[model samples]
Target chain A: MALVEIKNVRKNYGTLEVLKGVSLDVEKGEIVTIIGRSGSGKSTLLRCINALETINSGEILLEGQSVSAKMDGLRQMRQKVGIVFQAFNLFPHMTIEKNVTLAPILTGKTDKQGARKLALSVLERVGLADKLKAYPEQLSGGQQQRVAIARCLAMSPHLMLFDEVTSALDPELVGEVLKVMEEMAAQGMTMVLVTHEMNFARNVATKLVFMHQGRVWEQGDPKTLFANPQTPELKSFIGHHAG
Target chain B: MRQFSFSDLLFLATALEWTFLMAAIALAFGVPVGLALALARTSGSAVLRTVATALIELIQGIPLLGLLMFFYFGIPVLVGKDVPTVVAVGAAYTIYTAVFLGDIWRGGIQAVRQAQWEAGACLGLSWLQQFVHIIAPQAFRIALPATVGFLVQLIKNTSLASVVGLVELARAGQMISAGTFQPLLVYTLVAAIYFTICFPLTTWSRTLEARLNGAR
Candidate 1:
C-alpha cells in the first residue's frame, strides 16, 4: 500500500472550488513534486494531504487510516506527518530549540531532556546546531527555513510536506534552503513538494504532477514530463515560464 | 487651601490600590474572554460570528456610563437584589474592556499569515493546538502593545466609578474640592496624579509597539 492515498478530494472556498475531485498516491520514501500556475490547486492539494484545508468531499488515508479531526486521528496521523511552510512560521516568542522541542515535549509526551536531545540532533542535521539559542527573527530567511525544517524533523515523521518553502527567500538565500532539502531527499525522506523551482523538481522528484484549473493535467516521471512534449498545456507551461 | 499634606499623599497612595486592583481585575477577566470573542468574530460559523459581532457592536455603541447605570439599576430590578456600587462599576468596565480588547485582539490574530494556519495543521496539530502553539503566541506579540494601552485606559476609566459612589481618585478629588472650595488646585493635583500613573505606561506601550513592528 502507498504511504498516502488521497481519494477524490475536493475543496471549496465559498463560491469558488479550488480543488475538484483530486486523487493521487505517494509511495513510501518517494519524492513527489506538484507544479501548477497560481490558483491551480497545487498548494491546496498539499494542504489537503496534511488535513490543513478540510476537504469538501473525499478522504485522505495515511497508511490505510483516515485523517480526521478526532483526538485519536490527530495522535496517529500527526506522528507520521510533518510540514514546512513558505513563510517559516517559527514561534516568535521561542528560541530555535524551543520551537523544535515544543511538540515532542507537549504532545509526544517525551521528557524535556529527550526532546532537547532530539531537537539538537535535527538542528545538527540541518547544519544549524550553533543556532540553538537564536530566535527566528535573529536568523536570515534561509536559516529560518532550515530551523523550521529542523523543527519538523524533530518529530521524526514518516512524510514531510513542503509548500513553496523557498518562495519567500531572497534569490541569494534560495540555494541554501534547496540544498538542505536536497540532502533530506538523498537521505530517503518522503516528501510531497509544491514548488516553483523547476531545477529542483527536474532533479529530485521521482514523480511530477501538474495541476491546472483544479484538476491533475498530467503525471509522469520528471524527465519524461519536463523533457518530452506531450500536451499543449505542458508545452505551453514549460515554454512560457523559464523556471 | 492647604499645602500638600502627608495625609493627602497617604490618601493618594492608598487610592493607587483601587486603581491597580480595578485595572488588574479588568484585564484578568477581559483578556481570555475577549480572545474567545475575537475568535468567534472571525469563526466560520455564521451564527456564532453574527452573535459575536452583535455583542461587540452593542458594547462599542453604548457609553460606559450607560452600562454602569444598567448594571447598577437594571441588575437590582432583574434579580431583586441590590448589587454593590464597586462591583457594578468593575463589571461595567470589564464588559467595556472585553469589547475593545476583543476588537484589538482580532486585529492581532488576523495579522498572522494564513500560511501559518496551514503549516500548523499540516503538522497534525488540532485546532486548539494551533491556537495555543502557533496562532496565540504570534497574536500575543501583536496584542501586547494594545493590551498595555488598554491597561492605561482601564486605570483612567476607574475614575468613572465615582459616579456609582465608589471613592476612587476622581471621587476623592471631588470630595476634597467640596470641602475646601478649591476646584482648580485640587483637580489640577488630581490630573497630575493621573498623568504620573499613566505617562510611563503610555510611553511603554508606544515603545513596545515600535519595537515589535520594527522587529517584524
Candidate 2:
C-alpha cells in the first residue's frame, strides 16, 4: 500500500470548488512536489492529507487507515504527519527550545529531559543549534521557517508536508530553507510539498505533480514532466515559470 | 456647621478597606467565571455560543446600579428576608465583572490569528490542549491592558455599594460631607484617595500595552 493515498478527493468553499476529484499517492521515501498557481488547490490538497480541511467527498488513507474529521484517533494520525506553514506559525510566546519540545512532551513521547535532548538534535538537524533560546520574532523569516520545520521534526513524523514554506521568505533567505528541505529529502524522508519554487521542484522533487483548475493536470518524473510538456496547460505553466 | 476633622478622614480611610474588599471579591471570582464564559462564547457548539452571548448581553444591558438594587432591594422582597449589604453588593459586582471581562477576553481570543489554532491541531494537540498551551497565552497578552483597565473601573464602581448602606469609601465621604458641610474638601480628599489607587494601575496598563505592541 502507498504510504499516503488520496482517492478522488473533492472540496468546496461555498460555491467555489477548490479540489475537484483530486487523486494522488505518495509512496514511502518519495519526494512529491505540487506546483500550481494560486487558487489552483495545491495547498488545499496538502492540508486535506492530514485532515486539516475536511474532504467534501472521497477519502484519504494514511498507511491503510482513513483520515477523517472524527475526533477519535485523529490526533494520533496527525502526530505522524507534520505540516509546516508558509507564515511560519511558531508560537511567539515560547522560546525555540520550548516550541520544539512542547508536542513531544504533551504527547508522552518523551519526558521533559528527553524532550530537551530531542529538541537539541532536531535544532541541530536544521542547522539552528545556536537559536534554541531565541523567540520566533527575534529570528529572521528564514530562521523562523527552519525553526518551524525543526518543531515538526521533533515529532518524528513519517510524512512531512511543506505548504509554500519558502514563498514567504526574502529572496536571499529562500535558499537556506530549501537547503534544509533538500537535506530532509536526501535522508529519504517522505515529503509532499506545495511550492512555487520551480528550481527546487525541478532539481529535488522525485515526482512532480502539476495542478490546474482544481485537478492534477500532469504527474510523472520531475525532469520528464518539465521537459516533455504533455498538455498545453503544462506547456503554458512551464513557459510562464521559465521567464 | 461642624468642621471637616481628622476623625472624618480616618473614617473614610477605614471605609477604603471595604471598597478594596468588594473589588477583590469581584476579581477573584469574576475572572474564572469570565474565562468560562469566554470559552463558551468561542466554542464550536452554536448552543454554547448562543447561551453565553445571551447571558453577556443581558448582564451588560442592565445598568450596574440596577443590578445592585435588584440584588439588594429586589431579592429581599422575593426571598422575604433582609439581604446583607455586602453579599448583595458583592454578588452584583461579580456578575457585572464576569460579563464585561468575558466579552473583552472573547475579542482577545478571536484577535489571535487563525493559523495559531491550526498549527496546534496539526501538532496533534487536542482542542483543550490547543487552548491551554497555545491560544490562551497569546490571548492573555492581548487582553492584559484592557483587563487592568477594567480593574480600575471595578475599583471605582465599588463606591456604588454605598447606596445599599455599605459605608464604603464614597458613602463615608458622603456622611462626612453631610456632617461637616464641607462637600468640596471632603470630596477632594476622596477623589485624591481614588487617584492614588487608580493612577498607577492605568499607567501600568499603558506600559504593558506599549511593551506588547513593541514586542510584536
Candidate 3:
C-alpha cells in the first residue's frame, strides 16, 4: 500500500471550488514535487492531505487509515505527517530550543531530558545547532525557515510536506533551505512538495506533478515528463520556467 | 470660610484606601471572568460567541454610573431588602471591568496570526494545548498595554462609587470641600492625588509596550 493515498478529493470555499476530484498516491521514500500556477490548487491539495483544510467530498488516507477522522484519530495521523508552511510560522515568544522541543514534550513522545537531546540532534540536522537560544525574529528568513524544519524534525515524522517553503526567502537565502530539503530527500524521507524551484523539481524529485485549473494535468517520472511534454499546459509551464 | 486643613488631607489619603479596595475587588473578580468571556467570544461554538457578545455589549452599552445606580437602587427594590453600598458598588464595578477587559482581550487574541494556531495544530497539539502554549503568550503581549490602560480607567471610574454612599477618595474630597468651602483647593488636591496614582500606570504601560516592540 502507498504511504499516502488521495482519492477524488473535492474542496470548495463557498461557491468557488479549489480542488476538483484530485487523486494521487505517494509511495514511501518518493520525492513528489507538485508545480503549477498560483491558483492551480497545489498548495490547497497539500493542505488537504494533512487535514488542515477539510475536503467537501472524497477521502485522504495515510497508511490505510482515514486522514479525515476527527479527534484522536486525526491527531494520531497528524503526528506522523509533518508540514512546513510558506510563512515559517515559528512561535515568536519561544526560543529555538523550546520551539523544537514543545510538541514532543507535550505529546509525551519524549521526556524533558530526552527532548533536549532530540532538539540538539534535530537542530544539528538542519545546520542550526548553535541557534538554540535565539528567538524566531532574531534569525534571518532562511535561518527561521531552517529552525521551523528542525521543529518538525523533532517530531520524527514519517512523511513531510513542504508548501512553498522557500517562496518567502531572499534569493540569496533560498539555496540554503533547498539544500536542507535536498539532504532530507537524500536520507529517503517521503516528501510531497509544492514549490516553484524548477531545477530542484527536475533533479531531486522522483515524480513530477503538473497541476492546472485545480487538476493534475500531467505527472510521471521527472526526467521523462520534463523531456516530453504530454500536454500544452505542461509545455507552456516548462517554457515559462525555462525563460 | 475655613481653610483646607492637614487633617482633611489625611482623611482624603485614608479614603484613597477605599478607592484601591474597590479597584482591587473589581480586578479580583473581573480578570478570571473576563478571560472566560474572551475565550467564549473567540470559541468555535456560535452560541457561546453570541452569548458572550451579548453580555459584553450589554455591560458596555450602559454608563458605569447607570450600572452603579441599578445595582444600588434597583437591587434593593427587586429583592425587597436593602443592599449594602459596598456589595452593590463592588458588583457593579466587577461586571463593568469584566466586559471591558473581555472585549480588549478578545481583540488581542484575534490579532494573533491564524498561522500560529495552524502551526501548533499540524504538530498534533490539541486545541487547548495550541491556545495555552502557542496563542496565549502572544495574545498576552499584544493585550498588555491596552489591559493596563483599561486598569487606569477603572481606577478613575471608582470615584463613581460615591453615588452609592461610599466615602471613597472622590467622596471624601466632596466632604472636605463642603466643610471648608474651598472647592478649588480641595478639588486641585483631589486631582493631584488621582494624577499620582494614574501617572505611574500610564508610564508602566508605555515601558511595557516599548520593551515588547524592542524584543520583536
Candidate 4:
C-alpha cells in the first residue's frame, strides 16, 4: 500500500465547488510536487491530508488505515504527518525553543527536560542553534520559516507537507529556505510540496502533478510530464512558468 | 458653609475604602466570567456563540441603573427573599462588569492570528489544551492594557452604588454635604478623590498598551 492515498476527495464552499473528486497516491520516501494556478485547490488538498479542512466526500488513507477515524486516531496519524505553511506561524509570545518544544510536551507528553533537548536538537539540524532563545518577531522571515520547519521536525513525522513555503519570503530569502528543504530531501524525508518554484520542482520532485480546474490535468515523471505535457491546460501552465 | 471638618474628611476616606472593595470584588468575579464569556463567543458551536452573544447584548442593552434596580427590587420577589443592599448592589455591578469585560476580551482573543489556531490543532491538542497552552498566553498579552482600562472604569462606576444608599464614596459625600450644606466644597473634594484613584491607572494602562504594541 502507498504511504498516503487520496481517493476521490471532494470539497465545496457553499455553491462553489473547490475540489472535484481529486485523487492521488504517494509512495514511501517519494517526493511529490503539486503545481497549479491559484485557486486550483493545491493548498486545500494539502490541508485536507492534515485534516485542517474536512473533505465534502471521499477518504484519505495513511499506512492502509482510513484517516477519518476517531480524533485520537487522527491525532496519532498527524503525529506521523508534519505540515509547514507559507506563513511561518511560530508562536509570537514564545521563544524559539518554546515554539519548537510546545507540541512535544503537549501532545508527545515529553517532560520539560526531554522536550528542551529535542527542541535544541531540531534547532541545530535547522542551523538555528544560536536562535533558541530568540522570539519569532526578532528573527528574519527566512529564519522564522526555518524555525517553523524545525517545529514540524521536532514531531519526528515521517511524511512532511509544505504548502507554498517560500512564496511569502523575499526573493533573496527564498534560496535559503529551498536549500534547507533540499537537505531534508537528501536525508530521505518523504515530502509533498505545493509550490510555484518550477525549477525546484523540476529538479527535486520524483513526480510532478499539474492540477487545473480542481483535478489533476496530468502527472508523470518530471522528464516526461514537463518535456511533453499531453494536455493544453498543463501546456499553458508550464508555458507560462517555464524558465 | 462650615469649614471642611476632619470628620467629613474621615468619612470620605471610609467611602474610598468601599469603592476599592467594590472594584476588587468586581475584578475577582469579572475576570474569570469574562474569560468564560470570551471562550463561549469564540467556541466552535454556533449555538453557544449565539447564546453568549445574546447574553452579553442583553446585559449591555439594559441600563446599569435598571440592572441595579433588578438586583435591589426584583430579586426579593423572584427568590421569595430579601438580599443585603451591599450584596445586591455588588451582584448588579458584577453582571454589568462581566458583559463589558467579556466584550473587551473577545477583541483581545481575536487579535491573535488564525494561523495560531491551525498550529495548535496540528499538534493534536484538545480544545482545553489549545486554550491553556497557545490561545491563553497570547490573549493575555493582548488583554492586559484593556483590562486595566476597564478596571479604571469599574472604579469610577462604583460611585453609582451611592444611589442604593450603600454609604460608599458618593453617598458619604452626600451625607457630609447635607450636614454642612456645602455641596460645592464637598463635591469638589469628592471629584478630587476619584481623580486621585483613577488618573494614575489610566496613565499606566496607556503606557503599557503602547509598550506592548511597540514590541509587536
The residue ranges of model 3 lying beyond 4 angstroms of the native Cα positions read A69-71, B1-6
The 0-to-1 C-alpha lDDT of every candidate, in the order given, reads 0.84, 0.93, 0.94, 0.87
Please list the residue runs of candidate 2 whose C-alpha ends up more than 4 Å from where it truly belongs after superposition.
B206-216
Classified by CAPRI criteria, candidate 1 counts as acceptable
State the lDDT at B7 in candidate 1: 79
DockQ scores for all predicted structures: 0.40, 0.69, 0.70, 0.56
Q: What digit string (tens of lDDT, one per residue) describes model 2 on residues B1-216?
A: 888878987899899999999999998889999999999999899999999999999999999999999999998899999888888888999999999999999999998898999999999998999999999989989899889989999999999898888999999999999999989999999999999999999898888878876654
- Residue B56, model 4: lDDT of 99
lDDT of 1 by residue, B185-207 (tens): 87898899999989999898888
Cα TM-score per model = 0.87, 0.95, 0.96, 0.95
Comparing 1 and 4 on DockQ, the stronger one: 4
Which stretch of 10 consecutive residues in model 3 chain B shows the poorest summed lDDT? B207-216
Candidate 1 matches the true fold with a TM-score of 0.87
Model 2 steric clash pairs:
none
The TM-score of candidate 3's chain A against the true chain A comes to 0.98
Cα lDDT of model 2 by residue, A1-243, tens digit? 999999999999999999999999999999999998888999999999998889999999999998988847999999999999999999998899999999999999999879878989999999999988878899999999999999999999999999999988999999999999999999999999999889888999999999999999999999998999899999998999994
Question: How far out, in Å, is residue A34 in model 2?
Answer: 1.0
